[model samples]
Target: MEVRELLAQTHKLPNVPDIVRELIQQLNNPNADYGDIADKVIKDQTLSLKILRLVNSAHFGLSRKVSSINEAVVMLGMTQLKTMVIASGIAGSVKEVDGLDLKKFWSDSFRVAALAKWYAEKSTGVDPDTAFTVGLIHNIGRLLLHITKPKLAEAIQTLVDQSDCSRSDAEMERLNFTTPEAGQALLALWQFPENLGDTVRYHRQPLSAEAPSPLCATLHIACYINAAIGKQQPLEEVIAMFPSAEAELAGLPANIAAVSEEAMQIESGLDGLI
Candidate 1:
């Protein structure tokens, strides 16, 4: 099936609650009113409670309860919000597919997102929030593949079972393209921001990205790091792929350092989130 067909099948894919999606979009808009944005967030009772809890969570470095969405936003900022959104989306959408290994998939995804946030902070002026969102959404093509063609998903697994190749390599060799491209295409169609779509498209090959992006180099390196430790790739080789990846990872600045620390504090704070 095609991309549109895949999305159509996602009626079973889980809704993110219109208010949640709206809050993210408004957060992105320069002229968006904060009061209206908070109002939208408060529309979803569960999400609002979750946001408040997250604000009070150690991840935000806050000592008091965040009574409102606006204060939560101020305390946690957009990066953590994206994490909550994605984590919640995942919890709401997951299915029990026979023979599919979802745990390994998300462990690697979250780990890479963590590393990518660090790299983005080190590499550019890109908000660590944007970096985290890009990293979390980068693998969406896999999600699409399962939704579009279940047989292809099983087939891809078989290929991986028999080969040592990366998923991007497997997809490109077999399909004449990669998941990142297809994913970026779909998110663009869904009206996600251009830079976000670009990040998903070029995450694996930052050097040859289609659009100019500050997040590309970092995402590439972050993914490499996860592939290095989380999967089969050797650490030395993955670090070697990018000139100073090892050094950058070793030298993460204060805020990024704090983020990493928070990641360790809760193995499952925003459980059920993307």
Candidate 2:
């Protein structure tokens, strides 16, 4: 089925919370204040608990426990609090999918998010927080597919494994559209910024556009590095195989050894969240 058809069945897609939608709007609004954002988050008991849990978790390594949303905002800053809220909202939206390991899926996503943030920090004009948020949500299309068409999604995975092909290729062959396309569609439907949708759409082919997006290139390299790390490849070997073209596209320095080391260190922190 086409992505539109998949999304047309609104009941099949996970329901994004109103609070998440509001917070997503805040992501693009510079005028959004910490007090206002914290007030909004505090209203949602479930989401508030999750955010607090993450803040107090080993992820932040706070010296003292944060017991309130106001305190969390003060401790994490508006950017970080917003990222965590949006992430918690999105993850909480979907409870489960048949034949999918939700824990591992989120864990891998966090790795990509952390890596994307690392790359963004090394690049100019790209917001590291935005990069991290986009990375966390980039593969959401796969979850949408699993939710709407479990059998087809499973078939695509099977094809990917048997042929040792990329998931995007397998998705195109099976569904006539790629996961990035689906993810872009979902983000658009969610009323996220147009640039975010574009980044997700072109991440698989970061240079295909007339003016290549550094954010997209950053995500591309992050995914590449995460995949390499997943294979038990040594950090030195992974860095050795790093695509210089992508690094150039992202406007990051040639020597990223320090960035890679710092990014990889956050894996343990992310593990507690999952």
Candidate 3:
């Protein structure tokens, strides 16, 4: 089925919480009343608890425990607080997917998020928090597919396993669309920022965009590094094989060895997030 068809089966897809929708809107609003937003988030005890647990966990490395949403905003800054709230809301919305390894999926996503944040910090004029948030949700389409079309999703996975083709190729062959495309569609349906949808849409082919986006390029690099590190490739090998073209598109420095190490270190400390 196409992306529109996939999305039409609304019952099969996880719903974005109202608070998360509001937070997404706030992303582009510099005058957003964060205090009011924090209050609204706090009212959702479950989500707020998850945010607090994560912030106080070893992931954030905050010196003191954050006892409330307001405290978390003050300690982590508005951008980080919004990121946590959005992540917590989205993750909490999906209870399970029958054929998916939820733990591994979230772990890898978080790693990419951390790495994207690192790269965005190094790139000129990129919002590190936006990069992190996008990285975390970049693969959400895979989860949606597993939930809505388990058999087809399994078929695609089997095809990838039995062939030399990449997952995106397998997805296109079977579903006529890639996970990034589905993810972009979902983000649009959720009324997230257009730029976020654009980034997710072109992350797999950043250079293909009319105007290459630094955030998209950053995510591409982050995903590449995450896969390399997952394979236990040495730091030297990863550096040598870095996506230099993408880096140039992102306006990052040529020597990314130190950046990679720092990002991986940060990801290593975020086990609690997954």
Candidate 4:
């Protein structure tokens, strides 16, 4: 199927939680208040509960258990709350996709988010929460494909396994576009931030982005670090493979080993949410 048709099918799948849309509006409004945002979140009981659970999870390492959305807002701040809402919203919509293990997919996504946020915090010119959200949602196109066109997704996977090529290469060969392209289209449909759309679109090749985006570069290196960890590559080799130029653009350290360790730690703490 054409990428356009695939994206149209994705739009027909299901709408994200209403609260997510509302929260996005709040994020865009400079006059929005923290209490107002928290109120919007609590209106969706399921999403609010999920957010509260994750906020109180060991992943956050909060000093006290968050007992309410208001408390969560106070503790996590609006930026982190927005990230949780987006994650919960996406999770609510796409629980399972054919031919994909949601568990492993989300696990990998969480690792990338952790690594990206870690790198973003150490860098300048990018918000860590935005980087985290971009990392978490980057591969949504793969899930979209599995749900809307499982045969195509399966074919891409087979080629990936047979040729031992990267997923981006397999996707480009089979579908005429990579997962990041599809992800960008989907994000645009969802009314997410343009910066986020660009981050997902160019994560595989950050320097190829039309404009310099520090978050995109951060995700690029974070993905590399995730791949290294998956292969159990030696730390020295992982460091050697670090995209130094991209890291420089993102203003992030190329310390692959340190970022890998942090990603593992964060991934472990986020077990229940995924």
- In model 4, where do residues sit more than 4 Å from their true spots? 10-14, 22-31, 58-65, 253-265
RMSD of each: 5.1, 1.9, 1.9, 2.6
Candidate 2, residues 42-82: lDDT per residue as tens digits? 89888888878878987588999999998987787877787
Better of 1 and 4 by lDDT: 4
Between 1 and 2, whose TM-score is larger? Answer: 2
Write one digit per residue (lDDT tens) for candidate 1, span 28-147: 566756556456667767767766766676655677777977676677775465467655554345654445567666666666667666665665465666666667667877766766
Candidate 1 weakest lDDT stretch, 10 residues? 257-266
Clashes of each: 8, 0, 0, 0
lDDT of 1 at 199: 79
lDDT of each: 0.61, 0.81, 0.83, 0.77
Residue 159 error, candidate 1, Å: 0.7
Model 4, total clashes: 0
| Residue lDDT tens for model 3, 87-157 | 77777678788899887888788788888988888988678878888988889888888888899999999
Provide the TM-score for each candidate, comma-separated. Answer: 0.72, 0.92, 0.92, 0.87
Error of 1 at 58 (Å): 6.6
Candidates in descending lDDT order: 3, 2, 4, 1
Candidate 1: the clashing residue pairs are 79-129, 86-273, 86-274, 87-272, 87-273, 87-274, 88-273, 88-274
